[model samples]
Target: MSELNHVPRRPLIAAFLSLCCGPLGQLYAGRGKRSVTLAVVTLVLMIVAAPIALWIPGGHVSFKLLMFAFACWPVFLIVDAFQCARKARQQRLHWYQRWWLYPLVFLAYLGPVSLISELRTVFIAEAFLIPTGSMHPTITPGDRILVNKLGSRDDVIDYGNVVVYYSKGPGSPLYVTRVVALEGDTIEIRDESVFVNGKQISEPYAAFDGELPTYPNMVSMQPVVVPPRHFFALSDSRRRSMDSRMLGPVPIDYFQGVASRIFWSRPRQIDFSVSPENSQIGAIAWERIGMPIR
Candidate 1:
């Protein structure tokens, strides 16, 4: 009877570790080889899938698939940990022996995984919230946008491309604006209308809050040639935006990424200038959610 009966195992503890840092519970349950295998597989999948999903055409579909895979990964680890704990109990393995291993296992398993995830966010892509109406009509003050850090890699930054760049000014460190002129292009503003290479460009995305032919006292400047490796950018709201006209052309190195799409948006009280105040209580703009930014 003693040989036939299985010792009891704590399923809750196993599940907690697996969910917190995948496969860690398996090691705790004395399934060392299996835990190592699961960790390697998860890391390999992320390494292979992330770049493909971000860089290739029709990659959004692959990205969705990868996201689904990630969602399932933790669940699989939890189930495996529970099952392994049961097996270890059945095999009459001591549950609490070698207690010193827990600390080492945690540092080895969780530390590297956390570092890799952070590095991915820093280099691959990330999201940001729009706090101003500068890009209004296209992107509003309460919209959350995804920025693809790899968007400009191996590609040319063309006119009309919306980008996010690090600003060295007093406001936010990052600013979102549209590229009006690329390297070697001539840009001039006449009465708020943008002229590139001596030709007036059509700007359907541009918006003005009030009935005004042009922004009053808007600085008018002569044609200026964009220096190499730099870009001239402006906001859609010509009247309210502080852009290249005030800061000069942005350097290529200052660029952080390109705006991919609007993930979320909300309409805030018109009077509130602070972002947190606007988000406190507001109706969701369902129509604007998931809207793609051009």
Candidate 2:
């Protein structure tokens, strides 16, 4: 299979493309070339390693490794582009004759990822973590989740829904919590009850047996209105969570990706299974393994 066919056709192609750009070279090579498989594998591994490098903080071994990986991919991309163009020309492909088109395509691939994620520091999922608790008993912290990097871009925040967003850091981030109130919606958590805009929201998720005004002041005010584009989020576990009551509203821009699926999970620690329910509380959480973001 792919493991047995680990070869990079154009060293310059592989290096420049993988280097000057991040993983675009491998993306271009894709399944078309013999070397494409290994390139793709490298890119994926690089992406997985990226966050650990950043989390290592400025200058650690992991960070250094990530930096090297990030720097190295574009080299492969450039080389790939050149070779692809060359091949296209030899094969009499018209796009090759344009000459300048090559760089244009390369630039397109490079700009969005580098500028959007790196410069703006937008909260995209470099990765995700498993969640635990009943507040969001629906989704435990330890459950593996895949995030859609460009999911939350809506101007109007809907109520009674699950949302994953960036909340702190330059944009402290990475969570899959539920939306309790939209901007301008007054929410009160008092005496173990919730009222939004003077009316309570119907929650099927909060199955806990107690309550108190989570945001006493904000909830008691004359129905506070959520600011445009801002959202009030809380753990389904209204009482103990350090959500909006603790950190205020979740800014829209902090949004990186929406919860997508659990590509993999290890409820058994080391055993491989479809789901914990089958594998049964912390078994493997099979039902959620490949579920999509709602």
Candidate 3:
């Protein structure tokens, strides 16, 4: 007599496990060798994708294609696991194939994966959703941005660099604006014209939003020297940007990172009519997706 018990694998169980993590479904279906191979492949793909998604400067369309490929891969794995389970004959269960081992294995894998992801978010890059149009034409409301936390080095920051930083203090919320003045530079605003070190700097991205004459009081400021280890930032939407003008010069340590690109964006309502089926609702701003932030 055989020493082990033979039992049929459930297709639904296999599919669900695959959905959780690529190789898991195959493991449940008693394909130990295939599951190990799939696990290695999936791990390699994730390691490759992370750096490309964060640092590579590809075309907006190409970035979307990468995202689409990643989304489709899991679906392929799930389907494969389901079909394999359906065709698999009853087989002797090994020690690793115990019913209790499934969830235990999942938890063991999930713990380390979650930890690495959280570490990356804290020290490398993080995604943010724009809730206001303070940056306006440069960064509109509903735009989802990727911020490079590793690129916030004070030495690399320069005039016109868009940065994300703390609003007031270490524990405060983050704000995004363009750097206009560096440490030890004299910065002034006269009639909405910016001057760094007494020379008026070009501001092609600046916008008045048709309210130029209305905020005359807020548009001009006397010359102010940026202190050591500090920088001045302002919004492109001069008429209504709550930037360094309101918050004052920001300390270098307060900076979180540089705004990298628009990973995703929600479409404006005026661009398309609403559909009864809600198809148009929550539509994406396709043109802005993957656009780099200068």
TM-score of each: 0.77, 0.49, 0.88
lDDT of 1 at 23: 83
RMSD to native, candidate 2: 13.6
Show the colliding residue pairs in model 1. none
Better of 1 and 3 by lDDT: 3
Clashes of 2: 59
Worst 10 residues of 2 by lDDT: 89-98
Root-mean-square deviation per candidate: 4.6, 13.6, 4.4
Q: Write the per-residue lDDT of candidate 3 for residues 43-127, one digit (tens) a residue.
A: 6666566557766666698888888988898898899899878877566766577778888878876775677678778877889
Query: Model 2 off-target regions past 4 Å?
Result: 1-33, 36-126, 155-157, 169-173, 209-223, 267-282, 292-294
What would the per-residue lDDT of candidate 2 be over residues 1-294, giving only the tens digit for each residue?
122232334435534655555444434333234344544454465455434432344333434455567666555556655565344332322222233544665676455555544632344454466544423456654565555444346733456656666668344645567787876676776544577877776777775534444555423333445677778876776554556766777777765555544444544331123432332235666455544333
Ranking by lDDT: 3, 1, 2
